[model samples]
Target: MNQQPLSIPADTQASLLDVLREQLHLTGTKKGCDHEQCGACTVHIDGQTALSSLTIAHMVTDKKITTIEGLAMGEQIHPMQEGFIA
Candidate 1:
């Protein structure tokens, strides 16, 4: 599926976690260990599992950065969240 590109400010740091939390205000992508030791900052970049903490924001500027917030279709819950509850 084709996704829209999310532009990141040039001044922003390379860390995807920081961009999402600070710039985009997507707090669902938690930051456990900024050193990329923990998997808490896991997110999907273009439908693939990505460690936002490790990835640079600028590198993925043209890519789709899917966080926990983007999972839901409006009020509906995403499949991942639903599966976890079951």
Candidate 2:
């Protein structure tokens, strides 16, 4: 895993969804309802579920953000994800 920490502004007003998609180029997190009505933009913030559409980019600077790309370890899928697949 080549996980590297991203340094972003602590006062950025951009949404987490935009940061993930446009900045980081992580397109796995889709943009559904920007109002958080749909769950398409769900992500894990410090191991907790969060709606990326509504999350502020600055608010997550001090926290770990896990997207769908981070869900697996090489060829080994996470057990929770395996369960869902089953």
Q: State which candidate has the highest lDDT.
A: 2
Task: Assess every candidate by TM-score.
Answer: 0.76, 0.79
TM-score, cand. 1? 0.76
RMSD of 1: 3.2
Q: Tens digits of per-residue lDDT for model 2 on 1-86?
A: 11667885434788888888887888878899787688889899988999988998888766888888788888998785575468
lDDT per residue (tens digit) for residues 20-47 in model 1: 8887787878889877687789898878
Candidate 2 local Cα displacement, residue 42, angstroms? 0.5
For model 1, give the 10-residue run with minimal summed lDDT.
1-10
Candidate 2 regions exceeding 4 Å error are 9-11, 78-86
Report the Cα lDDT for residue 85, model 1. Answer: 57
